[model samples]
Target: MKMNKNYCFIYSLFFFVVSMFFFLFGISIGFKSMIYILEWELINLNSSSVCFSMLLDFKSMIFMSFVLFISCMIIFYSNLYMNLDYNKNRFIILVVLFVFSMMFLIISPNLMSILLGWDGLGLTSYCLVIYYQNSKSYSAGMLTILMNRVGDVCMLMSIAWMLNFGSWNYLFFYYNENLSLELNMIVFLVLLSAMTKSAQIPFSSWLPAAMAAPTPVSALVHSSTLVTAGVYLLIRFSNLIFMAEMNNYLLMIGCLTMFMAGIGANFEFDLKKIIALSTLSQLGFMMSTIGLGFPDLAFFHLLTHALFKALLFMCAGVFIHNLNNLQDIRGMGCLVNQMPFISICFNFSNLALCGMPFLAGFYSKDLILELSLMMYMNKFIFILFFMSVGLTVMYTFRLIYYTMSMDFNYNSYFILNDEELQFIIPMFFMVLMSIFGGSFLGWMMIDIPELIIMSSWSKYFVLMIMLIGGWIGFELSNLNLLMNSLYLTNKKLVFFIGNMWFMPYLSTYMMNYYFLIVGNKIFKSADSGWLEEMGSQGMKKIFDVMFKKNQNFQDVEFFIYLVSFFMWIMILFFLIIFKM
Candidate 1:
């Protein structure tokens, strides 16, 4: 069979779709089994050790279904999105590999397989990000790769520690082993990895930089696969984290990342970059839930975020494509009159992203906030959560207002066509899902009607804060004084954060002046000195003298035997010492 390049791309897509189908089918079957088991009131955890070991229960099935479903949708979305690119085949291959890696991560039965998939997913995302090979994309890809490797190393070390000193079993055996100090250190390292992978503080600049990739790749990675891997790991190893009782550190990191990213998003003008920062903020919420021992809430919010964030990215892609890759919100205006369908769907997704009442974002986000209050009872974390929610609405509507509400002299040259409509349709379905999916899931998950009503208090308060923040952001965006002052203040704040409070600059100067400059000059001069040069020249001379002349003789057996005897003596000496 002759292999065609285009056929390869097609096959890649078909293979991914089939893989996704089986994954989702497995989840559905698991769900059915759960229902039957629940109905008959049976406990079957011990019947199948493999299933229990793998965590393939109702909770895992629910999350796996959401992940696979979104993976399939994004694959479909990418098909249309990548049509104009020249390297469509390569893109498809990486996309398929990315999805396959994520599925493997979710279904893996042990830490080793999970880490294998985790690293694969990270490497594939790095390739996809730099696929364009431009300076910005290349730089962003390199930074992302570097930061994720730091996290990967932490995870690998933790796993190794567990295997050596703690647990070698597929299940968490260390928790029962009474190794408190070792287990706590491992949990801390894993949490550090989670923070880095999820783009928490100090490692978050890479994610905003990653906006240079194609929108679909950014959407798929930041929304569903790569970034979420950290949270999934935390949830998977909840027992270890809880055992270490490191919730305070988790809560603090989550709250700080949320506020920092939220403030950063408010300053962003690039359409996709705004969404990217919003993802960071949303991820903080998920992490905060995990910190509160509410992995279920975190998983719920993850599903809601995947739907709306994907929709937002796809919609932004359509606008950029129609406008010949123009990305600034200032370059667009009154799109509602031109692309009414897209405008409506974008608004719906944005609202859901903003956590408007009864929407997908509302249910999961409310649950997270409620759980946060219950777990921490700290005003600072709660306030940060509220402020993040408000800022989320602020930036989200800023996107809507600038793109759809303002007046602009749009050229008829930039218009959506049938090909673009294909991309929009998937987003339309996502908007529907973002509005109704959460409510349906909420009904299924929670049985108390009053609990739902109680959850509404948090929802209503968040909505109110969102409304206020939107109004303030809209007003300030239009005013010269407030905008200029806010910009100045933001620059100062970013400067402080970027410099790590000037300690980095101090350390750099110290290393350069005291170590690098003096050490390098001294070392160079010493190397060039007569004694060193003589040593190098003498070594080369010795080598030449020893090997330059060769004599061929059949009577060289004695020399060979002498050399073998010396080698054996050295080997025996080293072996004796090594054994001792």
Candidate 2:
């Protein structure tokens, strides 16, 4: 126990100091060109060499600083969260590896080195997902790794194709856009890889299923770094993919993912899954913002979202731990009274998620909406953007109503409290950041507001959407306002929305079902049927029949052998006499 605490403290301090140093370093590098680590080569392949290279610019340093800071706080929080577990050391070590991989990804300018970090995240995250040692954890871990492997393979393909460009160091081309034909395909492959990592559309089922992981792992993977990896990659390569056909496809897909996740979150019963869907929704939102040529805005939302979402997961972890692993929100009620402090933090985080004014989400989401409207685009995109934004509020309000309606659905000895020192210490910092992150990030990121200026009614459009969304959420939650049979009335629609439109089934079954069926058929035909008849089994049977036939000829065979031996002796004796 002492060893655990000591390790945690030492790691936390080291990360904290590193974060500060990076932040100071980033501030000092005002408007300078990117600095590369060009000291030595890590590998050589004939004319081309793989080198140990890093890119230190404002973007990387700032992002790295924030990632490290969150990791520092989370590690400290884990010291308390994992105090009872004997495998706490293993958990801590995995987390360290996980965070280190993320940092490596942030700084790497070479595709090969970035792949090292990318594959490391997939591997460590799989281990972390299955840390619970249960059947559910195993399945979830397999799903997580398989989904991420798509991205890994895509990245490897990109690296292979990049060899045509002579150098894997992409910093020179990053500022421009493309290198040529081969490099353009590399850009396309990178986008596809990011989509899987970011949980966009068809690749999205794995994020919710990943809830089988420990909530702390969820906090890290879903909230801040891992899920956003795709968007970050897009942002990093924003110049290359701009205005391409694939870029437009990505924008549309991102919008659809947002809409789907919003509806799914409203219908989700499990607290963690609801939050996971929300993360999916927000990832779509960020990707769409990048699509709209506002990657800086997407990045702003990404950072702000990370702060509040991490806090939200930490609070969810607290709730799950206290409720004895009961995650169904239907059984939860009266949290406002039982856990007032937690209720406050939950409300704060949820409000931020809903884009409440002056909160973290507002700073980014508001601009995205205004930009969507201001852009001379068609009506379809505008509606999708607003609908997605409204759904964010609707689901958030539904979650709040379910948890705080003063009804005590759970009849157990369990009691929820926010008094634990472990809970309070980590949460306090996140709570403070959730409160101030938007304004701070806004001041730093946006030089010119460029907010849309339209009719008076247009300025309040975002507010109107939130208000209407909240009202619908209220009606949905209140039993007195609607009949209980409403769900049955729209059964098909409810199921489609409630089950995320069967996306999980499609992603899982559609991918493996046909392949498994064909594989089984081949196995039966080759191994069990025709091959057995043609192989050693059939050969042994034929030899046995021949031996039986030979037994009938045993006496005749002996006579022939005796005659042949006499003839050989006579021939030899005659030859010896002739020689003499």
Highest lDDT model number: 2
RMSD of 1: 10.6
TM-score of each: 0.79, 0.88
lDDT of 2 by residue, 149-172 (tens): 999999999989877767787765
Worst lDDT 10-window in candidate 2 = 30-39
Query: How far is 451's C-alpha from truth in model 2 (Å)?
Result: 5.4
lDDT of 1 by residue, 186-240 (tens): 7788888887888877677677777878887887887778889888878877777
**Alpha-carbon lDDT, every model:** 0.73, 0.84
Collision pairs in model 1: none
